[model samples]
Target: MQCPVWIFAACQSLNNWQQEAGSLPKIGVLAIQGDFLEHGKMLDAISMDWQEVRLPDQLDGLDGLIIPGGESTTIVQLMDIYGFRDTIKRRTREGMAVWGTCAGMIVIARKLLDKRPEPLGLMDIEVSRNAFGRQVDSFETEIHVASIPGDPVHAIFIRAPIVTNVGPEVEIIAEVEEGKPVAVRQDRLMATSFHPELTNDTRFHELFCKLSGS
Candidate 1:
């Protein structure tokens, strides 16, 4: 059978990455709340070192940041209390690659269907909170990302948000059905409505590392 184009690209990327293995990108996981440690472990599994970003100053020496899945309201409230909201927005615009998963996706959206905790409005996308039902409705499914190689990624959704629309600059990388974007990217910003850290797959994280330009 003919190998998929993405598989070839993945192999090439992995080879290039291995050649530069001596210098992997420095990554940070937002640690105020959510599954930050899980993301850190995933990075460790990929032989990458990462710091836990709690204060705004800690965000300084990072090539990329991962906002793990958690309660959006609680995380937003903590961000406000710890004065990370404005700084995060500022740094992100200054060319920091950020990947938001699940509730993190909700935090970066330009608009939310419900008017609750205001979003950071970093990514030009609209999201519907808990669109995949509630905690009881959480489930897993295989998702294919064109840029990632190998089999489809198994994603876990827990009180996950859904990407309803994306702006002109946003590129939809993965979807569940026709016109339903599940993962999107714009410049250095990437967001996914499911938790990839919850699984053993590291391709998504690797893709984010590449986007970080490190």
Candidate 2:
């Protein structure tokens, strides 16, 4: 007996009937910080879904998060005001990946050398905030990504942080000519002392997404 066609189809479908978690990972950008819109656009260009995480619920099921570059002090203040610091800590601790670029690095620094107010203290590394001069000293460079496909990435550093001290678990990825650490990765988390979103190149973000498996 052949049984019923629908019954056979259902039997075959049962092996692959699991529901999807929805479109690609919902990347969250801390809107309270600087360059949030810019990063949002980058995400859109890459065809990845993203949202400005201004509330605690926004971080609920994000596959990955981005703390965009901005003023460190003000960014931290907003994080506290919106109660995102605690949520970020919880998510990062539970194996959710995070990428902190420029001022984002300072916000997640566990040990900030500069004499600024406390931060979210997310990463376990020491950072020197705003190593580059103020607005006048802002500069851009083509950074070398060891595993990238083509030429180095064009990174824009506007009052970016300098990773002077990375913990044993942290792996330094890229640096400037002066040996200033620009990119560092600790497990699934990543931090850059520059703003990749501000550049036309998308290597940095692609690399980050690859690492996040999203």
**TM-score winner among the candidates?**
1
- lDDT score, residue 128, model 2? 93
Model 1 misplaced regions, further than 4 Å: 1-15, 18-22
Evaluate all candidate structures by whole-model CA lDDT and list the values in order. 0.84, 0.76
TM-score of each: 0.90, 0.85
**In candidate 2, what are the lDDT values of residues 59-160, reduced to their tens digit?**
888878899888888988878888887889999887777899988888887888865758776777789987887888989878886656566778888877
Please estimate how well model 1 matches the true structure, expressed as its whole-model Cα lDDT. Answer: 0.84
User: Which residue runs does candidate 2 get wrong by more than 4 Å?
Assistant: 1-23
Clashing pairs in 1: none
For model 1, state the Cα shift of residue 42 in Å. Answer: 0.3
Residue-wise lDDT of candidate 1 within 34-101, one digit each (tens)? 99989987776665668999999998878888888999999999999999988888788777889999
